[model samples]
Target: MNPRRTTRSSSTAKAPHRHPRHPHNPAGRGTGRLLAAVVAATACLGVYAVPAHAAPAATGTEPVVSRGVTIPAFYNPPARLPAADGALVRTEPLTLGLRLPGLDGRPIPGTATRLMYKSTDAGGLPVAVTGAYVEPSAAWKGGGPRPLVALASGTMGQGDQCAPSLALEHPLTIGNKTLSVGYDNLAVYRFLAAGAAVVVTDYAGLGSTDRLHTYVNRVDEGHALLDAARAAHRVAGASITEGSRVGLYGYSQGGGASAAAAELQPSYAPDVNLAGTYAGAPPADLTEVMKGIDGSALAGALGWSINGFAQTDPSLRAVVDAHINATGKAALADTSTMCVGDAILGYGFTNSKKWTADGKPIADIIAAEPKLQAVLAAQRIGRLKPAAPVRLATGIQDDIVGHKQARQLAVDWCRKGADVTYKAVILPNLGDKLLTNHLAPLLTDQGSAVSWLTDRLSGKPVTSNCWTMPVQP
Candidate 1:
């Protein structure tokens, strides 16, 4: 008999959701005055309270910083995008009154610009990607020219509405719905607070009118991220120079992008002066990660990869269409329009075996096909050498992306002569395991990652631990 494959599910498991980081804001004299006014008004009419500070709308044809344009196609390049990579195709000012997630009502103080820049896809074809360039309120008083960080956000679903640029304006926006919380915004705000200029890529095709996001496609993500850094310098009023020390920060999907950028920077974007990178819980090995998450709480991620591969790779698309059953096709179609929460809720604990015509799971089917295997292999990270020092953090007991694969990335990168610091957060308690697995590390490990990037930006030397460690077995 064939060896039985094991799978886990969170369908019946009950636990408090892992809470993301929230910005710290104090309610002072202004809040007190508002409360006093509300109390005074309770005597007659019970209707009134002061509204939170709202960000004003942008005046330009292409909005600088409103949620997003009504007709996004208007922003699209009329003709073919220029052949040059990292060229700034278009830019609009993002005003200072926008709100950061977790700190709603309080406007973010910074100069933010929405960018449309040229980048390459998996096919190496020129494409336009959307991004945001932000210069913090506090000037860069650091020793050298102002440091710039190319920040990539974690998975926010594959919809155009899930774009980080739109989320920056109204923190809770996802198309027409208002979820009121965005986990990645917290990290972006943290970078800005450190007085570093930030360039955040929505990644290729994510917020664009035509292309569907090639989620986790290494070349596409890396190209979009590096180009975001290059385009940041061209944004009007953005003082980032070519000489600025650049760093990379990302977790989950973003983590993969940052890691890819680090590897591809030498040849793809040699102009970027990379100092260091911090990648937290990157799904470095998609094959392993897919198998691990098949029946887990984050099973929905598998659907995302399927949808993405189908969109980007025609050979894989043919395989998927031929193999997927009616249920699977419907499931995949439904998820195309979903945001992160909907994805998790809609597909959590669902097994792929139910979606296939044959009894085998999707992974098994993919493994049996050479074309599918090759596509996945091509998307793998750790094969290429990153130009800068990289710090990778992961919870040892992670259930979603799997700790073994994440650890393997550190080992692989080290073998490739990368200056690697692999930090594993160890917590053995059952409650801790429940809370800290997978996504929780995104929030918990971010501070250390940020600090690591900070030291690099501050011109501190990075010492490699790869030589000291024993070889991976």
Candidate 2:
């Protein structure tokens, strides 16, 4: 069921079509002269010239913008959720623009297209969560319901700017950096080709005006997934029939998000028809993840845990604000906009020099902070069985989140009588190669995971091997 290798297809779908001339470009004297000449030439050929200011007719090429305005920072939530029950809602049209605010409360100046989805908050008010969908291409297919693949992005040491949207839209395509892979739109492209709709949540706060991303917050992650699906279906005029299947895929930070989504869907979004989820190398036990990656190559992950917990629980931040030195405070701020590489390069090799005084390890500093300890303890994911079918994969040599923890999660779920399809691969020669070791199982085992989803969409009965477990380590 696993894909033998990962490769890009040549005939993949392109972005929607657009006019040749730039719409925002100014018409100056020289430009006017050239336009006159072209007009004369057109007249000679018996063709009528259109006015420069004439509005171009709609071509279905434009992206759909959300109906809601950007959530202002000072805005407070109403006592009830907005009423969002309608046949399908379409938002205004918007050309790609830059400097837009993302869910993280930071200004991300890149090509963006917004869409509105349908949902109802706890109070039964019709609710619509705005989506700032961004991709590199402008020639993507504009019609039909594409496969919806909700990405659970990994933890970026900093805040929301570290979101995958940055790379997906404005990739580093020049020089040595060019050799480096930018954003991974492969998942989106793959599902799109399969005629599936894809929606990548900015999580609750990463791309919105919210102050924090809520990191491993189960409720927040669940809300993003459920609401995003509703939004995509509404904006795209796509239908999520009773048999419509949904799949969740993520790694590390995203893995945690996917796992939480799977666990919370039954109660949180009982209506969401989640067929199956693919959780790769999730940190089921946050405590172990914190302890294991404290000062190793993956140590940069600690920064995300710090920022996420600080943003979710006020008590956690008070502890951090008190224990961290001035340098640590500065580092935390800078981490917000930094990418994974920047984070690892800056603080990976070095210990929490900025956060601690007297040369103490960063973990020790956190351990001494009682409030932070409670915050870290709150992020754990266990004692809950995921309602949807799940396909969990992990590499035996994984060093970031550790394979043992992933295995333990599967065991816990199995014990709870939940349907689980767990796969553990022997990637010994891989060492601590995080990406490959973690993702290979998911990508390679496409037959089981993705095919299973296809079946769910078709309303086929689901079968699993949850009763069986691999021999103990």
Candidate 3:
């Protein structure tokens, strides 16, 4: 789970489906340029880290607006939730921080509505999740009713302000309020430009103030995504309908979310007309994934996982809390309030060994503690067969998120008779530990992934490559 950053000033960058609810690539030398740009830009990030303006939500329904960023007040759930999951909570006009106006004065990409909808968490409790629904002004040339895409974001961070809905409004934000790079805006607009409706979930507890963002919790993520689709149909002006062919798109953390949703759709959200799914570098096995990024550029994300795991499972929390040292506690506290960019610049290449009371890395601790291992095992995504056709891809040289485990997900699905298309992306090691191998493929393979999903949305069927996929690497 991670982020591929983009910026405006220079810097960068949600749900559960308990009840029936809604809801790529590698390449190129440009990867070298991108890696260099990131390195160059990071050295100066400290100067920009100022304190943000604050607006507390103690009494009224008011957003926390700081700099240009906003965490909408609508995120607050009512004390009473509707009987059905995916029930609409509220909606507001969401203005895009970056938008192109056509000659006629209409946003060329689309008009967006801020959404708060009900979704069941992994614990089967009702939660209010926030997101954005975009109705494209562009015409659909590829198909039937305009296809609806539920776009799941990769690892943003653990902060409430890091929500993708807010990012759509403020593409670049920094300082105490948040440190973000909204690279996903390009992906959002791409689908809009293709004449598709898009709904983006903020996930349970992410934008909502009820709890901590449960990062990489598969059931929670799957339910949130599926519920977003269910709620999309309720948006008053949205072009999305129950009949619209639904496509899932995600990479990194989002990859796992989309993959989970793909499997859960048939049972948890029978109403969602799922057509195809693209899961790029999915961390299907969290045990392996947790070890993969431990000392990489975005090592702070490990704290996010711990913070999330602790929030949902008291057993996991007990284990983590007992073994964690003061350094670990401080790191978790710091990362819980940061975005991916903040994590990268601050905790890059730091070892997890520094966090443990016994000076052992978390993976080793889990190896010694079976209770923690069970938590990770429960989070695994490959056990169930994914619905519809799925395109799973991974970078061969990825040091973060683990390429082998991602490919294994495709193999697992293939064995269970799911239609699968697997791609092994070959990329030069642009950075030894700077995340180039993992992040590069996201940018390079995006076009091919989008085309693949669009083809399925357009009713074009693809043949499965399962027969040729051998276990050997």
Candidate 4:
């Protein structure tokens, strides 16, 4: 559906789309204190918020509303697809929704360019991807040109309104009516404040008005991220150049996207040279990750993945449609229009067994269908060695994303002779399947993540820790 609106006057924005490598605050003590403060502040903001009004529609277009938030016109894609990947389809100024006072009186994080770019999906068909590109005002003192950090956001949800570009405008509008927290702002601003340019991808079909978001589909996510880099050069005022160094950053679902982009960079976008990568809590093995999320607080994510898989693969769709009950179908349709916050509010702690026609988990359903298994197997990351040093982190207590599968990504990469540094966040169980265990480490490791990546972007080199890592079984 197309959202019709006269362009609203733009506001200053520091894009909400960057990520870093470590959480140990290896950057400095001041940064560590700031990290804690940002977390606490966002934690407070990440709550049920009062509703806000969407700008009036200018012309006639099917306005897609997710949990009461209207998708903006900038997100609407043109009918024709560009033949070239990373082609700029459209661009506009974006205003971020950060109002933190006393942080040096900075009004916004950076200059945000709301952008729609061309990208190839897993099916090899050209598709439009929406995202934001921000040029930080700080000067680059890293002994080289300003670097570009293409950030893949952790699971925002399957909804168009959940797009990171939109979240930049409504980072904490979550409530009974709607919700989204650009929790990534900490990392995005961190890098921007340090004089790095940042680009955040909305992934294929997530923000664009063409199709449903292909959640965590490796090829789609990877291509969208890499293509964002190419598109950044197309955006006006973007300082990133063809020869600029690039780094990949993400956690959770974003972790999977960054990891996939690192591996695919060699074959898909060889011109985009990589510096380093930090993949935190990447769901490398969909099978294990799926089993873990089945009955968790974010169980609705299971529906999102299934919905995306079905939309991407018709063969898998036929098999999935056969097994899904009416309730399952309804749930998938509902989640297709919801952000992570909406999903949690609506379907927390739900079980997949209830969605299936039979009294078995969807994993069992997949086991019975070879087509489904093959498609899922093809989604696995770590099959290819990444071309840069990678810092892979996972929470030992995280049952939702599964620490083992995430660690296994490092294991496989290490075996492939990739420069891999694995950090297992050893936190006490903060209640299984409650997301606390899954997300606690994100903050704990974010400082180190950013520091590690910053070092790479600054021409710093890292020795591989693969010698201490074990190969996957």
Candidate 5:
């Protein structure tokens, strides 16, 4: 989801300046200090209403990533977690603002919880993952136990401060964009309005403090999403049980997670009775997406992906070092410390040739290497059949994650004998306009996608349209 820059004066102190993404609004730099004193005075006057769920009093020990920074104690997982995957580690009550970024000004009436749960990493090592659970204030009018949707957020940058949990607490502004006012929060509000309990995964490393987020790593993302559903059921005050009907929803980065979880559910979490999934604008082929973003507004995303690959895969690291030029090395280093806003500002519409000794995109370098190709192939979706029906939506002229590869996903799954509904959004005007093609459908098609998943969760019969669709090239 593309964040619309915020219009508010910098009355708020930006989260810390450890990252280059935190550009100080000089006009509002010290206002937060004044506001803090006002809050203290107000507390002394005893005029403030208490939050529904009081945060725990104990503070968590900071991790190496933010050694000198202060983080709330709720993010800390227990020192020891059960060896089993999908085990609930610990939970605490959380309260989000009534008004969030994309809610169209409609208040979100609900009880929220922050959950830390056990899940496997890409290599099957047990690790802790954090997520938020919301039991809607809206009543369930559908039927049976209120359904649960594991809502995964799209690219929120790799910064810990950009984590959705923190954004839900106090919106972080990237440039002028406040994260709490974006499409991800809007989607959560919609789910709650439909009377579904929602659990949003911060993904493996994004909120872990010590870990460098893995970005597009499929295994880690899928594991985190499925395990989030497991943790949601165990959350205190949540009446959801193992038998509760489950669905997955996400777009962009989130689309990748939902798609991967649907495929992994058969083996990784066979106990979860998944109803359906709606994946919008999923980067089905990371290699293709990497090439597509090389010189675009999101070119920094390519750097982010490369940085993540180097962190997790040793072979890829060696290859990157072997061919990367000095300029490329510095840019990559700089990208590591910045969030999406700074990345876009620094690297947008820039050529990848400047980064390579051979003057070619990194994708070309990886394509030439069999080992690197294998690494990317492992991250691709459609290798396994989804256990449940899937609804996939992509704009025909999407420039970032091209429609061709996204359409190919439907083809691959259909051949694998899975039921898939492929909807190709036709927006020639938006497509001709450049990047808006990819983002427009996120708003337009979301309601339909939600309605489709809601139908499945309500136990309606699914009619597969795979055979009638044209074969993707």
Candidate 6:
């Protein structure tokens, strides 16, 4: 099966220079010196500083930017994965003085104030993966191992930008404030408030020295979620000695990752006690979703699919390389750092127009390609039974990812004897609203899912009271 449908854009080419979004001094005289003084002051105050000469690093190596910071490289593993058992493992408290290499393998200044965490894959080797940790506030007063919530974020494309700490610490600076939206952590916060430990994985390539995030790669996503738990245990200190109850939460691209993690966890990380999983508006059927959104306003999503899948399928890569032109290629590479507006600018207007120039729609081009179709078809979810309880939610009005797909997923899971708590809600007062179209379902589902997860973490028995009538097509 083709698995390259979610490959990330390569970071080798120099990103075209663009002016900084923030204002710069026009005097230009002591700008460099003034910047240096500000960096020093910020350093004293424990704030992160952008390296003066910082540029996106090349593939496979970390780029050193300043005194203690580096941009990390993406992880590109050989075809064969190391055996999972007997891997070297260690745990340590996340302290302010601690630092780990960024995605480019460069030393990134980390803060203990925020509770950073780290874990290594075992094989009797130094584990390289690292992640951020946030503990539940005192309001959560459980005595035993707190419930654990692991967040698998949706597509941020750029490895450097996907770091959760960066998202949490510098939300306004990031292109898509959505990653910084704290929806992932909102679930985490609720769970934590109910006495749960929350761990958010940076995914493989996003935070570690991996070259490209596997996007929705089932095996990789599962591994990252499991590993993040181990890291959280290390950072939160031994008081969380008992293994905590585990739950997964994700949305959109993250939904796909969380679903895959749930399916893979029983065998992948059997020791971790996975209690339940909540996935909202997941693209259970990638091929269908791609067809549904091609050349639409959400067409930018196609770039993520093409890049992600190409990593595993050479034929898919060749097709994309062959079909897209120079500008299209550049635009795809730029997509990782872009927000919705940038997406509209980069793909919606330019790339979409170029691909459809021959009076053929972009979707028609994608459909005409056999390898691309196979790659996407292989990415569908709902083919496996989760070891733990599962909750699925989707909006009745979702236009980007059709609501029909979410319903089908729940039906498929139930038919497979999986305990599925599914909900399809009609978003009121959003008459034909595009913004509400895709998100209303997700937001409604997210609210319910958070409440459900909190109940589970609090040791309440699982129930299906959340389910509603099957949405009419």
Give one digit per residue, the lDDT tens place, for model 6 in 43-78.
432334344344555665445221112333332223
lDDT of 5 by residue, 289-355 (tens): 8877787666767766877777777557778888888778776755654455445555656668888
Which segments of candidate 3 are over 4 A away from where they belong?
1-52, 55-59, 62-70, 471-473
State residue 6's C-alpha deviation in candidate 2, in Å. 41
Once superposed on the true structure, which residue ranges of model 2 sit more than 4 Å away at CA?
Answer: 1-113, 116-147, 156-159, 165-167, 171-183, 365-370, 429-448, 470-473
For all candidates, what are the clash counts? 1, 36, 21, 18, 5, 32
For 240-354, candidate 2 gives per-residue lDDT tens digits of 3344567777766777878878887887667666777877778888766766675544455565556656655545666666667766665555444334544444445345654
Model 6 lDDT at residue 15: 26
Q: Write the per-residue lDDT of candidate 1 for residues 1-473, one digit (tens) a residue.
A: 00111111222101111222112213223323432432343222112111232223224323111112232433344357766787888878764324443344323556688888898888867888998888776667665888999989887776565677755654554222211134576778787888898988989866764555678888889889998988888888777778889999988889888988899999999999899998888888898888877875456667668877776766566678788887777766555544564454456556789789896898999889998888889888899998899998877777667788888888899998899988886745332212236666776778888889988987888888776446532
TM-scores of all predicted structures: 0.81, 0.67, 0.88, 0.88, 0.83, 0.72
TM-score of 2: 0.67
Q: Over 4 Å off in model 1, which ranges?
A: 1-77, 95-108, 174-180, 429-436, 467-473
Q: Better model by lDDT, 5 or 6? A: 5
What is the TM-score (0 to 1) of candidate 3?
0.88
- Tell me how candidate 3 scores on lDDT: 0.79
Q: Positional deviation of 192 in candidate 5, in angstroms?
A: 0.1
Query: Which has the better TM-score: candidate 1, or candidate 5?
Result: 5
Ten-residue stretch with the least lDDT total in model 3: 16-25
